[model samples]
Target: MRIAFLLALLAGGVYYTYVAFIDLNFLTRTGRLGPGFFPRSVGVMIVLLTIWALVDALKEGREAATNAGLWRDVAMLMVLAIIYAVALRVFGGFVATVLYLAVTLSVLNRGRPLQNALLSILVPVAVYLLFDRVLNASMPPGLIDILPI
Candidate 1:
């Protein structure tokens, strides 16, 4: 199952990298980094890391059986991912991210409300500044605008 998962990721990364290179320019007219840069870089890294993990898994002996708790955690994350996708469509980028991070962190990183709260707000703000201000790219727009920021 682990090997299959890694293989799937490898295939996705290859396809992503192919599209990044073929459909998008690496540099703009003035030679600044283009929109493809981040996706291309991420795709490449994903490919490399997946390959490395696959190799390691192949070398290791039989996998230990997963417990019920492990399965529960995985299910929780899967549900959370679906919720996050819906939240993205409903609340847009910034607010959805903030909400997702808050809930996810509270659940996963228990007993650290202060840390989770700080991270919930800070990471999205940083990403917003980086994408909106520095990269001049727009975040996903939602159905209704709530926060002006």
Candidate 2:
């Protein structure tokens, strides 16, 4: 499973690297810093991290056993992320992210309502402020737009 996780990460890293290369045009149109600069940097980082993860997995395979169900956790996280993506466009970032965090934490930590609620609300609000205010990025308004906040 660890090997599988490493392989998946490596594959994703490679795919993103390819995408970053293709997206270079978007970055080159502007000044020295292009739109692809950040994404390419991220791709490079992912590639390095995936390589490191693969090495660690190989070393651990030879050493003591490690049964953390890393793949299962990853799968669950992916599903939650997909849910959040779909919900974000339809339900808005706040609602989608809250639901995603709530569901993911509940599944992972066995449904602690107080903890889940806190995480769900706090994380989305923080992200909203960061992206909307700090980064000046646009996000879907969703149903919440009806209510004046």
Q: Which one wins on TM-score?
A: 1
Query: What value does the lDDT take at residue 149 in candidate 2?
Result: 26
Candidate 1: clashing pairs of residues: none
Highest lDDT: which candidate?
1
Q: Estimate each model's TM-score.
A: 0.56, 0.48
**Tens digit per residue, CA lDDT, model 1, 93-128:** 899999999999999999999999999999999999
Q: What is the C-alpha lDDT of each candidate?
A: 0.92, 0.79
User: What TM-score does candidate 1 reach?
Assistant: 0.56
Cα lDDT tens digits, model 2, 1-149, are: 56887799889888988888885644455456776788888998999988988888898776456556986788779988888888877778777777888888889888588988798899989998999889999767776554332
RMSD per model, one decimal: 9.6, 8.2
Candidate 1 residues lying further than 4 Å off, grouped into runs, are 1-65
